[model samples]
Target: MVVQDRRGGGTVAVAMACGTGLAVGLLTSGCSPDGAAADDQEPAGRAAPAAAEVRDSADALVRAGSAAVRTSMETASGGTRVAIRGTGGYDFATSTGRLRVVLPDPAGRPSGGHQPITEILAPGALFMKNRGAGVPADKWVRVATASLADGNLVTGGATDPLAAAELLRGAREVTYQGEEWLDGVRVRHYRGTTDIGAAAAAASPRTAPALAAAGDGFTTGEVPFDAYLDEAGRLRKVRQWFRFANGAPKGASVTSTTELSGFGTKVAVQLPDERDIYAGKIASPTP
Candidate 1:
């Protein structure tokens, strides 16, 4: 999907199918209602780490580069609501990853009326299995990484796990909000806000260009962030809320959350065979 950014003066392809609007391809549902509970609870099994420590650990993970992740986003604009969910793994060393996301309709249910879309990012291209109407039933559509720069701004383009981790490293005025259980793993929650430029600057190189493009013409004020870290200091969950000061489309505000597990897990993704992939121009979804 693609949206012409009237404010940004650029045409941006919506990167993931998770949600509509600026941010896409996030797993917004399936979360426990107490996901963002208050931090007033007393010290439980493990003590929470300092804000700096949490940032450092996330930075280290980005530097090391392999983890399984589940990402989601929920957005509301002009009375339209969307929710997206995806699960995949990233390999920072090779700048590659794979993700499968259930694209949401304006009403927040799965769109496409078919299976979830699967995307694989290699060194120079992105391969996708899209089951949307009019797409071939078999074979993958390949897109050059460069064509994704504009779309990637909010989607983070390649793998969201790495970009999400890097975004946490930019948090300022960090406060340890307390402890919580995520998928049964005890984690320390921290809250803070980050400048849009700083967050874009801190993202992994693979997705930074898109971040830069997305921030154009928009007054991206402070973006609130919430991060949860496990005892080993691995990033368990990260959420960012984007609210532009200016140039925001009417009713468009995006919130993205990504959860990580299987840290250090080795994941290998191979590109599809040339005979089995389509490298031609794809017809953009009708506006």
Candidate 2:
């Protein structure tokens, strides 16, 4: 697996042989929700509609078929911060998507000279291009999602858009915050905490393994999130917070955000042929 140096000046190709250690390196190196109802206010003491709507957010997207997505993942440690941003489209029905992710600069800013990494997301797998370091630019590197400690959630830099919505299924406590306009669309805002274990149990089979891995990998199974849903109960935006053991006593903190739009968009994602995948060993990054 290839990861950007903490300074963002170069890339490090960590051998897959390192196994879970690679996941820790990715987290320590700073490499790393749903919507609600319509009414402006829910009557006091009334059940928050989001409690139920959030769980169905993924189903709503499946019904929509596809949508364009924008994702941002920010990690902070020892006063240094970096972010990974991505843009592309997802086919919810097929559980596949593609994104071009841009790594941060030495200053942890998105305005960097680093080339964008193209990522192809599929059930139980991830394919990346321009992975840097020893990998050929034209050859894709594939990794199994179930093998990663974080289940490719933070390891891929940008969280899978669909996985982001599915996490909401575990919402244990949710409060509808009210309605707000997001990109000219009225959406209901909700805040809650989700249980990773619960989400994995409730997730579709295609996503269950990854979510299950996340439950075991993160320092805690509880995740805090904010979600925005449109009138149709479609997820418009979500932000989630995660923490993992990054070799630090207190661990590391990551904030992941996903925004959705252009519903019903036509998205064509083609996986690379076996011949196009890189089969050679990856060299380790220099000290």
Point to the candidate with the largest TM-score: 2
lDDT of 1 by residue, 99-189 (tens): 8877644333454543677877665456677634345757776655434433243443233565556555556777678778999999878
Q: What TM-score goes with each of the models?
A: 0.70, 0.85
- Model 2 worst lDDT window (10 residues): 13-22
TM-score of 2: 0.85
The models' CA-based lDDT, in order, is: 0.58, 0.78
Worst 10 residues of 1 by lDDT: 25-34
Compare the candidates by lDDT and give the number of the best one.
2
| Angstrom error at residue 281, model 1 | 3.2
User: What is the per-residue lDDT of model 2 for residues 21-94, given as tens digits with 9 covering 90 to 100?
Assistant: 12324333443322342335454674546578888898998999999999987655444555678999999999
RMSD of each: 7.2, 4.9
Error of 1 at 280 (Å): 2.9
